[model samples]
Target: MRHRLAELRGPGVPAKALDARALAALAANPGCGRRALLDGAGVDKASLAERLGAPAPFGQSQFALTRGNAFEARVKADGGAELLRLAHEALDRGAEPPARARLPDLTATGPEGRAARTALALREATAEAGSWTLLDHPMLALEVAGSPAFLEPDAVVVHPDGRWTVVEIKSFPMLDGAADAAKVGAAARQAAVYVLALERVAAHLAGPPEGPAGAGAPRVRHRVLLVCPKDFSNLPAASAVDVRRQRAVTARQLARLTRVEDIAAALPEGVCFSPELPPEELTAAVEAVPAAYAPECLATCELAFHCRGRSRAAGAVTPLGRPVRAELGGLTTVDDVLAAARGEAGDPDDPVVAALRRAATLREQALREAAEVAACR
Candidate 1:
């Protein structure tokens, strides 16, 4: 499977590692087979989009990156004493104050080694009974579409009761005890991926004899701590975000995704997505895999622009938005929708067709009334 993925990514091309953000986005749009297959193969979608003449417009500025890094550093300073305190206040109020906690060294050679070390640390922390253990930038592994994706959360804290909580640090300001809802939601989704990865580790530690949530197994908390700057100051503020829904949705989507090997087997021979390939060939390679395009994808996917262009060219009503497409009901193209609205086609008994005709009549009446008023004036 790995060899096949490598071939799809092109000979001698290094595959891009999938991060928590990418995994969250993939989970949010599970119906997009193109994204699932490309991501599973570790293909760089940004580069692919660039070659296809629709470069992705989403990226953080260098200044924003620097500020974010500084904020994260401050939050994690002093062996993460401040971070632990915030976690206690936000998620474990009744427990003993985190005046002192253990910060284990998770440094290792590579991702696999780090993941192993993290698993070991979690086990040790769970065994400590009444101690608080903080792991900074712990590496975790989660399988998506039959591929292993390594995720590193900002921090993971093991509570006295053997409960593990994920901590997300961001530079976005939390004013009046609230941050931007969209940013917070994105953070929650990203953290949900971490929580899911932690559960996999916990399950492994529990073994098959004992179920994942067995007595001795580590417990992954569904509520993750979101730490961000407070108001206009650089001070850190914490909020507990419930991610049970996001975790459940992501888990289900991942479970139902088509395996990378299966998608690869169905592709034509000699198809590759290397940016070095000719433009036409690269386009062909991308088009080989069907995409579920929606306007919502513009914010999350690097290949959204390319997919949007194709969707519009094919007259797919999906570009109008998912909700609009749903309301259109079986009207998959703009031409079909217009024909229905004009009463030239479609079954008159159909509720959707009747609604379209009524809407068209109202629109025409409004336009006519405005024109008549203007002419009178």
Candidate 2:
């Protein structure tokens, strides 16, 4: 399967593994077969985007990147004193606060070794549950589209009670009691992936997969701690985010995503995505896979601009947004909608067509009125 995906990427280019952010984005837009196949194959979407003539949007400003690292360093400083204090306030309100924390050493040579080391740390934490344990920069593996994606959460907190909590630290400010809704949502989704990954580790901790995490098992809490900057200050503020919904939704979406094996099997015998190839060949390789493009993809996908251009060129109305496309019913393209509006296609008696006609009439009247006002002026 790896060989097939590599073939899809041509001869010499190294495959790019999907990081946590990319996996979260993939979870958000699982319907795009192009994204699923490309990501599953570990193809470098950014390079593909540039080669296809649509560079992705700007990445983080250097200032933001520097600030983020500084903030994280501060939060994890002094053996994670500040982080533990915040965690105490966030999840262990009823119990006494932990004065000390165990910072486990999970250094290993590779991802598999690191994952095994993390699993050992988690089991150790569960067995010796006298104090708080923090697994910092632990590596976790989750299988997506038949490929293993390694994820690193900010921290994992193990309570004295044998349950584990996923801790997510973000540089984004939480202002006046709340953070930006969009940023918070993205963070929540990302955290949910971490939680799901933690659950897999929990499965190996000895419970029969359905029982409570106790003497024989360790459970991953559904509510994760979200730590962010408080107001405009650098002080970390923590809150519990209930990711039950996000977890369930992401799990369902992930399961529904197209498997990489199937995508590879369906490909033509000699397809490749090598940037070394001619533009025409590269373009043909990309277009061979069907993509469900929409405006929302811009925020989460690097290939959005390229896909949007193709969608627009093909007159696909989905670029207008899903709601608008949904309203158009069987009319899947902008040209189709325009033709229906002009009574050149679609039965007028059809409810969708009638609504489009009415919308067209209102738009025409509004435009003429505006023109009249301009003419008089």
Candidate 3:
């Protein structure tokens, strides 16, 4: 499978590693087979979009990146004293303070090694009983579409009672004990991915269900700590977000994704998504996989522009948005909907067709009334 994925990514092109944010976005749009296959194969969608003459319009400025890094550094400074304190306050209020918490050395040779080390650390920390353990930038592995994606959360806090909480550090400001809802929601979804990854490790440590319930196993807290700057100041603030719902949704969506091997097998003999391919050839290769395009993808997907252009050219109603597409039923194109509305095509018994015709008649009546008013004037 790895070899096949490498081939799809083209000769000598390094595959881009999938991060938590990308995984979260992908989970949010699980019906997009194109994204699933491209991400599964580790193809660089940004580069692909550039080659296709539809570059993504949005990216963080270098200044914003530097500021974010600086804020994160400050939050994690002093051996994570502030971070741990915030976690304790938000998620583990009744536990002992995080003064002199253990900051284990999590450095390892590679992602696999780091993941193994993190799992070991988690086990050890769980055994300690009443001490707080803080793991900074811990590497975790989650399988998506039959591929292993390594995710590194900002931090993971081990509570006194063997509960683990994922920490997310951001530079976004929190005003009046609140942050932007959309940004916070995105962070929550990203944190939920980390929580899911932690659960995998916890499950492995617990092993199979021995009796009625797994006893004394490390528990992953559904509420994650979100750390950000407070009230237009550089000072840090933290909020505990409940991610149980997000975690469940993401897990379900990830499970529903089509396996990379299956998508690859259905493609033509010599299809590759390499950005180096000729423009026409590359376009053809990408078009081979069906994409569930929606306007919401514009913010999250680098290939959204290209996909949007294709959807518009094909007269696909999906570009109007998911709700509109869903309400259209069997009518997938603008022409089909328009024809049905005009009573030129479609069965009269079909509820959707009848509704369209009724809407069309009402629209015509309104237009006629407006024209009469204008003529009177």
Candidate 4:
């Protein structure tokens, strides 16, 4: 019935349309200025009332992937209407079909998209070598805590030792020291969720135990591997999680899961599962994902312009898309970049930023001189 209902619905409109509506509401209500967009959508208030759950609600991997596909379609189409049409077509087909994946155009440089393309090429190379099954492989739904759940790992491989390993391909290059712990921990948690789900699936398929009767059990052990570049410029590296780490993560996540009810209760009236954070905060937050601003995020993040605006305003590309306007300690404008270039943004606090600033000044000065020369001639 749920399947039929989904089939009956038309393709989904872009989440931006929903965001636009929410933004409009915020515009309309300047007093308390409601931040709950999900409530405005009508799903938040009605569906999840008083549901004190254990643990924070995390998105299933399949749900994340499906929404990602929808966003990709929207960006490729340049609007919401076309996204809706594509979504409806997908729904009518009963299950979403695989579409050709979009690749970023790296040569057209505004920023460092090539770094991402390089990482992708390496992942493809690994896939070619059969180090892992390539992405988009059809995976069967598995049992989760006695309920059926479907998942598709970014990559999966059957090791020669006969263990199933789940691979999450992150485009970020590993940073030095323990500085990247939070980033790594988050990835590990997500991977652990998949591991737990997969374990249940393996157990379900093992069926009834047979003693001397020669019945074999499924040989799936939970292991996870995260593939990331060790350094900039396509250096190969990976982080492997042993069963012990997986168990520790699983325990922590499960404990958090139990409080899902409380989180739901604490949410403002009418809010739904849709997450919300200020555009400013969210931009800063993802930077913690280390190269999370890969083409995927740039294309899909509705707040990309907001983040980019902040980055450009700040004058340094290191923390791209940061809002430094009005705070003016560092370079905050094109003029500030110019000043820095001319030894003017005070000290050489940031040389790369100063260099870009200097270039801009040179270009401006050249333009002015060209105009004066032309006028005189």
Residue 192 in candidate 1, Cα distance off native in Å: 0.9
Candidate 3 total steric clashes? 0
Give per-residue CA lDDT, model 1, range 1-377, as digits (tens): 88888999998999899999999999888888899999988899999999999998887999999999999999999988999999989988888888889998999999999999999999888767587889999999999988899999999999887789999999999999999999999999999999999999988875322222356544888999999999989999999999999999888987888888888898999999988999899999999998899998999999999999999999999999989988999999999999999999999999999999999999999999999999999
lDDT string, candidate 2, 4-33, tens digits = 888887788787877777778788778888
Clashes of 4: 21
- The parts of candidate 2 lying over 4 Å away from their true place are 208-218, 364-377
Full-model lDDT for every candidate: 0.91, 0.86, 0.91, 0.38
Which candidate order results from sorting by lDDT in descending order? 3, 1, 2, 4
Candidate 4, 1-377: lDDT as tens digits: 22221221113411221221222222222221112222222223111211212122323488656654543333234322332223324222242232322222223232124323323432343323312122222233432212233444454443222234555555555655221665565566556655654455445533432322124533333445555545653333455554447445454433322122232334344332322434334333323221212122232333334334445555543343323332334554566555666665556555565555667678889999999999999
Expressed as tens digits, the lDDT of each residue in 178-255 for candidate 3 is 999999999999999999999999888854322212465438889899999999999999999999999999999999
Candidate 1, residue 294: how far the Cα is off, in Å = 0.7
lDDT of 2 at 271: 83
* Total clashes for model 1: 0
Model 3 worst lDDT window (10 residues): 208-217
Q: Rank the candidates by TM-score, best first.
A: 3, 1, 2, 4
Candidate 2 worst ten-residue window by lDDT: 207-216
Per-model TM-score, in order, reads 0.94, 0.93, 0.97, 0.33
Model 3: residues with Cα > 4 Å off, grouped in runs: 207-218
Candidate 3: what lDDT? 0.91
